[model samples]
Target: MAAVTMRLSEIGQQLRAFRLESGMRADEIAARLGVSRAALYRYEKGEVIKLDTVQRLAELLKVSPLTLLGIGVEYYSRPIGFFERIRQIEEETDQILQIADPVAYLVTSPDYDRVLFQAIAETQDAASGEQYASIMAARKSAYETRRPTMITMLPEQAVERFLLRGVCEAASPSPELRDAARRVAAAEISRIVEMIEAEPIGLQFSVVSEVDNTANCMLMRGRERMVLAINPFRADTSPAASTGVSLITSAPEAVNAHQRVIEALWKDSLKGKEAADRLRLLLAEYAIR
Candidate 1:
């Protein structure tokens, strides 16, 4: 076969992700590939590697040669570029674990899907940005169609806030518009309530009475890749919102650290009927008022 032309930086990313998700230390993988630790670091830094060495790397990582030649985890500070990359990853992800705001980012039911899109459409119309409209539409469509295995950790207060105030970003908007946003928010919360009660397939839902927002993020776990995105802003309003400095790693060290944190938090959090009843009480209070 002819040698494939792949960018060192991109290939480096795949190697790192594969290494991390595989839960192997750099030294272990490097030793298996018959390279010094420093050489392995250089390879992961996008340094040139011989085609024969690429074959060794594929064997060590237990992946096809093409996998290493393809896309890898990336970090982005810019809004448009970061969101575009995230949209791509999200579309491809088979499982998602999120530390959500009032509304869950993914795993929303079909009835609530319309509400989420309406919130996005309203936010887009207010900004008058055609590009964002398309981006948000694509994101919503991807989630609706894929509906990847979903798990979320939601803050109790944030859910109450979202149910009441909604995510409309209109500046001094009309009452009817504001009402629409609230309805969207309400529906989004209702689905969570429903999920807890129904426990649909591929859905794992939970609510935590208190969650440290600083550590919250959306963690997408793919079969061969993993992305940990840190976005400070609540995503209920728009999928294209400017995420804070995000971390994308396929390295075992970092991904495992995050996994431990998620497990610890989930253990301390509320779920099943307990979480549902608490939310239901809030729902009733908000509705009756």
Candidate 2:
């Protein structure tokens, strides 16, 4: 019975993930499933789910039955869904192994959110403002409360581009807004330098030379499972990004491979005072440009 409950709980988590990816409301799904909304929420809360119901849900959510059974890949085309899923994973994560250019969203400066919201507002509809804000707040709150150990690898070239282009990637911007964006970018880099110098516990940041054909991904190590998310949607770089599909999987081989790659990169990457000094020099050289 205990084993069955645990399996059911995992299936519930997968159901929630794919449901968000499906972009279908609870009531809508309930109506289509011929079940009460309360019942649908109960399933998400880990109640025993019938096999027939699982088949119906797989059909409605456009995912294979094996996926809901927690044995298949989870694909997300919507950035909102992907980010929300990330938040869910991070909630239970013990540590995060991340490889992204510039910096990961969790380590970004506080002001980064405002700049990001503005850029997203410029590119996205006003209807999505509330949802975006909620997700942003939830992510920040989860990180603050959990404080998971994070090891991030950032590329030097990406940091250079961040300083050169600033945070706002909107198509057209007023001169004053552009200046403000650049200032924020410089401040963010400064914050990163400070972090590198401080060498805080449970937080590791390394800067590596730019390499060709690298993917943005993160591995979240949890108490029971390790999940890898290969994401192309970057809020810091491009707020209105919607072209790429993010892949989330718990396959051991996939997780092991990414972990190995991160270890290899960390071995040759610059860290501590050396990384701080390099970033400071980049800041000075790029501040004038």
RMSD, one per candidate, in order: 11.6, 2.6
Give the runs in model 2 whose Cα sits over 4 Å from its true position.
1-7, 168-175, 237-240
In candidate 2, clashing pairs total: 0
Q: Quick one: best lDDT, which candidate?
A: 2
The digit string of per-residue lDDT tens for model 2 on 1-289 reads: 6645555667877787677667687899999999999999889877888999999999999988877776668887877777777877888998998888576678777687777667666666675555766776788789889999999888888788888878755435566666767788888888888888888888988888757656789999988788899988765534234688989988889999988998998898888887888889889988535
- Residue 152 displacement (Å), model 2: 0.6
* Candidate 1 lDDT by residue in tens digits, 1-289: 2224433446765666556435467899888888899999898778888878888888876667755675344544334334544566787789888777666655554544454455556545544244444554567689889988888888887777776776544223456756766776667777778888998888877887855463557778766567777656554445445445555555666777787788787888899999898888878876323
Candidate 1 yields a Cα-based lDDT of 0.66
Task: Estimate every model's Cα lDDT from 0 to 1.
Answer: 0.66, 0.79
TM-score of each: 0.65, 0.88
* Candidate 1 residue-wise lDDT at 269: 87
Tell me the spans in candidate 1 whose CA falls farther than 4 Å from its real position: 1-80, 109-128, 169-172, 212-214, 238-243, 287-289
